[model samples]
Target chain A: MEMKKTILNPEGLHARPAGQLAKVATSFKSKIEVIFNQKTVNAKSAMSLMTLGIIQSSEVIIKADGPDAEEAIQKIATLIDNHFSV
Target chain B: MSLKIIGQKAAPGMVHGPIFIFKKGNSEINRSHHLFSDFDPSKETLLFEKALYKSLQDLENLKNKFTSIDKEKIDIIEVHQSLIDDPEVKEQTLAKINHENKFAYVAYEEVISLFKNMFSEIEDSYLKQRVLDLEDISNRVLFYIINPELNFSYFSYSQLNDSRPSIIISEDLTPSDILGFEKTKVLGFVLSKGSPQSHSSILARSMEIPCLVGAHELETLDLSKYTDLILDTENSEVILNPNINEVKSFEEKVSLFKFKQKQLFSFKGKKTETKMGKLVPLGANISGPLDIDSVIKNDAEFIGLYRTEFLFLDRITPPSEEEQYETYRTVFQYLGHKRIIIRTLDIGGDKEAPYIRIQKEENPFLGVRGIRLCLKEIELFKTQLRAILRASNFCNDLGIMFPMVSTISEIKEAKKIFNTVKTELEQSKIQIGKKINIGVMMEVPSLAWILKEVSDEVTFISIGTNDLFQYSNACDRMNNQLQTISSPTHEGFQRFLKFIVQEAKKNQLHVGVCGSIAHHPEIMPYLISIGVDELSMTAQNILTVRAQIADL
Candidate 1:
């Protein structure tokens, strides 16, 4: 699957969105990877995401692969679009 | 009478003799030579195996010698023991010794040196600390292989575990390693290698045990010589080798300290009201679920600010909702119908959350964070709120509050979410009890101007003066280049809080300061004077603050 690029809404992905992304990432059967800068981590792992320590409105790349890879990336993109504010 | 080092007297008593110092790194690095070269595949495998067993005994003996079991030291020994017994370290070295005609020392060096290089390449900090442990183990192995039956019976522990309290002098202590000392038996602690924030020191303070660190480099400092000691609590000073006159002075001061403490304790469960019958509530800032003990022991009437951040830090995984539920449940049960105002996840400032990735902001303090983070992360927020709501059922007086609130909209938004969670749990038939009151921190400037409008939406208000002052003058409180926000004595902050106090009273809502300003002895009387209902602070500052408030 191709990587999707998005500006992190609601400043950067803070405690809340990091948690939201973790929760959502855990929901699907597909494996999701989020890359910010050069660091890549499992988007489903809060521990891994937290270690990224990104701030507001950062450019983040979400990559996913599996049975629902397209749907997972779509859901994540929508979450970044909807839940994480301008 | 021997060469005396006036080190921190870790225990009380007297011992007179030539003092022997336990020196570290004294064992030479080349001590590994014979163990490596002599362990030939054809002959010395059995001898090599015999040496491994002997080293374990040496470790056991060293532990028995210590005033306490040094876990780091034990950890080091275990690593070395494991390495020696490993199939690679011994079998490979011995094979090389026999096949290649290498010396036993050369064979041994190859085994351990490989581990040393491997350890240096690992990236993790915790894993890196293990390299030192490995080296320490290597030293023990060298001693065990070379000396054979040089029994480590030289160490003694007659004075330790003698039913008398001790002032342990150590180079360092691990966070978990401090538990071996019986609390009552550890009168004080002095670390040659620790700080105010070290686990031992923090544990000592929480236990009300006196401690002083960074003055204990004299490891062999005669503990017996310094045993006639008194801990000067106020100064963190250990008065060593006290004469009769010095003892008399401390003894005289001891009663005065007791009397002062008695005065502080007299306010137990008492209203913060003056003789004039004005109610003045005293509260505390708690970091975790465990800090409630200090709050209860101090008899704090309520929890002012329950910092919910420590729940996330240093943990392997995020605390599940059930874990959060049990945690909050304990706080609620402990307080029992007393107001415990929990501040939700007030991170993204100096107290950063490791579990959440927030990008680097030019000014994180001014950036979108705090209550803002709460609104954006609904699932996590929902988990916390649900846990909190679940806990509130167990304690009717439990309350929740949001921190760094800048807008009335945030208050309205939180109230809405709180209701949604309450309803969701109700729909699930989760058997939660009682709806808890919610409050918003009035730290923003515009909120100060619009208190009547703001107070109508919330159950109570807490003035976060540390940030309120910082925001009021646009000064980063930590910035040395910026203007200082000193104390209540500062005219501007005094005015800001005064405005908050006056506005809060007019709106008929309870408001209190929960910043360091709350615990300031100098500021307490003024806060009382300004008509704030409650004062909340870190638990350690409560007793002295209560004393200062009693006067007003």
Candidate 2:
């Protein structure tokens, strides 16, 4: 499963929000990957996500593949939509 | 070998213990020239996996250990945790070991370096700063891979547990190492190289660990010969292999230090009062939310000066209302009910932001700055005002203070903008604090003479004696030649303070001094005697100042 989302944080994908995203991605069994600016990285790695420099309003595609792929996409999308408060 | 090494003091307090020479970044695995072909790939893989597992567990434990700290600090540990066993990092490391014929530590270092370089190239300063976090995690994993026999817990380490706490002697330490170490089991730190401003030293100071840095003699001496050592950060020297007399005297010093610390701690919950029963509210001058812990630890009656300029100084663009609101609200959440006086953006003197462009002037200090700069940049001023007003809803006692105000109109203009922002928010149905106090920093000397006129514009005033001293005496504070002239003891400056305090009392306005001079030993008495309502100083000085006030 795959979904597209815009980073809502003005200081986008900094340590705190990136850590939240990675923590959420790691909870699911899916092989989640986030692709931004044609660079693909593992979403379950905060360091990997931070290297993307996803600034405010930058749209990216989140791809997940496993038994829980659908649920993983739903969870990650919610996190991003809520400005990574989760 | 008995020797004395002089170093710069990074933190205070003293202890004597055996020297634990921490060889950071000196793992044999890191220095080895062995290629993947020199060893079994399967063995290297297993070794890497074990190190990775141990590192993950340590990260988990560190995260739990730091749970009581602020959320941002915990987020750092969590970031390291997520990246420790990251499949991406693992895949890259395995590729280096198998395909590139590199050892596990070498492979891991290569991957971390790659990410570090990648992060350093990024334009966002905040993301680029995370490179330090990467280095910290890499060091931890490398330490585990090399020294599997050494237990990761510093608290339960055999050498530390055998006798007195060990003084950590390292070339330098990462901030995380300082944070993750069991501070109780450690006497202090003696780094051969580091500056007082280094993050590690800052962490050492914050953690109240006695630390000495820049001991160049340590490089020549064989550390193995020095089993016992005295870390006297007060004297800025470490005594190696002291004589019985030296030991006995040093022991007395240590006990005295501990007694002084105990006395300071005892003042934590007591009211700051002089012998004459005059109650003086003591507060801390903080730069941001990070200082909230120290402020509370010192039992400050309030935050007298919260410099909001830190939020604006570092970024490519001025912080949006929401960003500033979040920052202010976080401070409010931490302070909870403590009266906080936040100074508006005082930029363009020593602090310059790329986003806020001011024409280079002959004298930037006398040029556009503080309220003058904010007034010229009305939109920026409004944005900050809106944020402060929005966050004021979170705290009961919030004071908005404008800095370097020289005229009545400037205060009225700032208040006008603030009132406009407040009204806009109210019209939008936003709830703000019902009674947010207004104040101004009395930095301009001209304003001192007209306190009666300015007092009506604001409920409180804080004398910014640093700038006020320099400006009043026509002495450049930065110039060494003007040191004598700019001294706070200058009869002119002393008289100015007394006059202002008298004027403030007559005007029925709460007045405080948020300046370096507030904690000056000789000047504190005059300030207290003059009936200043509050004295704001650095967090570290709170306990000592309180004790002094109590004695007086």
**Against the true structure, what is model 1's DockQ?**
0.04
Best-fitting candidate, scored by DockQ:
2
Model 2 C-alpha lDDT per residue in residues B86-117, reported as the tens digit of each score = 77789999998898877788789899999999
Top-scoring candidate (TM-score): 2
lDDT of each: 0.64, 0.83
C-alpha RMSD (angstroms) for model 1: 10.3
Classified by CAPRI criteria, candidate 2 counts as: acceptable
What is candidate 1's lDDT per residue for A1-86, written digit by digit as tens? Answer: 75655643423453345656777887899878989878887787543454465654567788888999999998888877774421
Model 1, span B249-351: residue lDDT tens: 7777777767877877776666666666777777888875446667878878788888887666543234567557777776777675677788887777444
DockQ numbers for every candidate?
0.04, 0.34
Judging by lDDT against the true structure, name the best candidate. 2
What are the chain A TM-scores for all the models, listed individually?
0.85, 0.97
